[model samples]
Target: MTAVRVLLADDEHLIRGALAALLALEDDLVVVAEAASGAEALAMARAHRPDVAVLDLQMPGGPDGVKVATSLRDELPSCRTMIVTSHGRPGHLKRALSAGVRGFVPKTVSAQRLAEIIRAVHAGNRYVDPELAADAISAGDSPLTAREAEVLEFAADGAPIAEIAERASLSQGTVRNYLSAAAAKLGAENRHTAVRLARERGWV
Candidate 1:
């Protein structure tokens, strides 16, 4: 029987290494590539053309897992995709599903369970953590527009309006407008509350 080729992408070194090691023990699985960033994951996936790509949800310095999965769906439709996140949010799960991810599980899942999930994904089945799916059902959709969410993410660090404008490449007035609109939509009294609410819902 042919082994399933897998690509593992995660920014955390220890976790990535441990996962790689554990997955190597599976008789029907082989780790074909490992990457520490989303960009690298894409590159590795292109080069290796693995049967499955298991990605971390919050890799730094590039697109997140959902974005990578979306790209892979376009560029490599045969390659199945899955996400493993330490921080699973309702909105994120929804985004992953929309991006055509076949599996979404928390990082706390055991290696044995993850291996089984990988097999399931390769067989074209979908799996989402039950708790996360329940939360996503309850959280509903985000009301904020793309621009509003982008501006709010810029404001997450409590930066000044001028700085946010510079970062977002918009005028201060525009930044304020987006923030205000976002706050109003979320029923937040202020932008800070808006940011907090959006973050808790994983909209930003």
Candidate 2:
């Protein structure tokens, strides 16, 4: 039997190693490559031409899993992508679906279930964790504009208005306006409060 060739990428060593081991035990699955970050994932995908790419949602020193998945849609159309994350946020799922990923799974799932989902995704079907899917449906549209969210996201990282402006290529006054608007929309008392509220709602 021809095994399903797979590539796995996650910056967390232990989680990545453990899942790789579990998948290796499957008779019909072959872990053809492994990576520590999204950049490494892309390089290995090009080299191996894996049938499926399993990636962590967040990684260090490179594109996040969503960006990697989006790239793979164009760079390796034959390879399907799956995002596995610890975050239970529904906004991430919405973004992943928009990026052409074939799967959205949580790290909390059992290894056997994850392998099953991978097989389904490789067979040209989409799969999402049931709870996350429901959450996505129930969550209303984000109250913050994309620009406002961008500014508030930096605030969540404790960045000053000047730094946020530099990173986003917006003027300091514009960034401040976005921050203020976001705070008012979220009924927050301050930038920190706005960021916390947005994060709790999974808007960031």
Candidate 2 stretches with Cα past 4 Å from truth are 160-174
lDDT for each residue of candidate 1 in 1-204, tens digit (9 for 90 to 100): 799999999999999999999999998999999999999999999999999999999999899898999999999999999999998889999889999999999988899999999999999999998988898889898998999999999999999999999999999999999999999999999999999999989898
In model 2, the Cα lDDT at residue 33 comes to 93
Evaluated at residue 80, the lDDT of candidate 2 is: 96
Most TM-score-accurate candidate: 1
Model 1 ranges with Cα > 4 A deviation: 165-177
Residues 70-181 of candidate 2 have per-residue lDDT tens digits of 9999999999999999986888888898999989999899999999999999899999999999887887668899899988888788888889999999999999899999
- Report how far off residue 3 is in candidate 1 (Å): 1.3
Instruction: At residue 199, give the lDDT of candidate 1.
Output: 90
Model 2: lDDT of residue 105 = 92
What is residue 63's positional error in candidate 1, in angstroms? 2.6
